[model samples]
Target: MTTESAAYTADIEAIAQVVAAVEHSQQHKDPDEFLALFHPEAVWTTAGGKVLIGLDAISAFTREVLPAADWDGKVTYEVVHVFFIRPDVAAVKVRQRYLSPGAESEGAPLYVMSRQADGRWLLTACQNTAVATA
Candidate 1:
């Protein structure tokens, strides 16, 4: 593979890991592990527009919500447009589809992500709209 192709492959894999982390945390309800995917100072917006800042908030929020989640699903990154803001700092805009619990349904949940200093992607915002189809 060419240099560009290899870079593309790496990005794809990284995005896959991001989705997997969300699914895994949801299934296991492990907030500690889930919070590890985010930066210590990360900020997020909930579906209801609640603002959460920092890892502590992330842990608390995930712990509360994951247990109540009826849907254990994945966020497939349909489009991940990336940019390197600085040499070691990068950002991405991802369009994702969140499958319903048991991986059913034709609707997509809204999600936004940001990368941590350790090179991991974390959900910065998420919102679920009514499924477009049954």
Candidate 2:
């Protein structure tokens, strides 16, 4: 494999680790873990249509909601697709699933992540949309 290809694979692995962290944070109801993935100026839109801009606002919202959230079952997030806009930037498509004995629902969240100078990927901009049944 070419050096460039190897680097690309490594980046995808790093990005997938970030996505896995998102899933981990959600399942554990750890808002701090979730918030730690974002950039300081990150922007996020929730499935419920609330838009939060910047780390402070996102932190405020997550802290208020995540811990208070009640879930009967488990949640999982998968990185379905990754589109690299540049060497240091990636647009990631994630499949989010909420599974329970009573019902199952899904969310499609698009997360834009950036690679920092320190070689860690952080969520930059994101939107979460619920899948609707017709």
Candidate 3:
């Protein structure tokens, strides 16, 4: 592979790690860790349509919901797609699932991540949409 291609692949892998960290923090119910993945001015919209602007708002919402989540099993987030808007910005599509005893539910989340000057990716904007079934 060309050096440029190899570097691009490395960037994508690093972004995936950041996304996976979100799932890890949520599954472990550590709001601080989850919050750390976002930028200070990040925006998050929940599956239920609540819009949280900025890290403080996001922190408040996550702290309330993550810990009180009633699922018995665990939650997972998988990166389904990643589109690079620029060398420093990407749009990521994620499949989120909650697994419980004899039941499962899912959401599709879109995360807009930005690469910081230090080469770390942080979520800047996100929206979680519930997968509806008839």
Give the poorly placed runs of model 2, Cα more than 4 Å off: none
lDDT tens digits, residue span 16-123, model 2 = 999999999999999988999999999999999999999999999999999887675399999999999999999999999998887889999999999999999999
Model 2 vs. true fold: TM? 0.97
lDDT of 1 at 57: 83
What lDDT, from 0 to 1, does candidate 2 have?
A: 0.95
> Which residue window of length 10 is worst by lDDT in model 1?
86-95
TM-score, cand. 3: 0.96
Q: Please give, for residues 1-134, the per-residue lDDT of candidate 1 as tens digits.
A: 89977865776567568766655665576677677766667776664567778878867888888778665544344444555554334455544455665565432344455656666666555453334553
Q: TM-scores of the models, in the given order?
A: 0.60, 0.97, 0.96
Candidates in order: C-alpha RMSD to true structure: 4.5, 0.9, 1.0
Model 3: per-residue Cα lDDT over 1-134, one tens digit each: 99989979998999899988988887888899999999999999999999999999999999998888888539999999999999899999999999988888999999999999999999999999999965
Least accurate stretch of 10 residues (summed lDDT) in model 3?
65-74
Candidate 1 lDDT at 20 equals 66
Candidate 2, residue 115: lDDT:
99
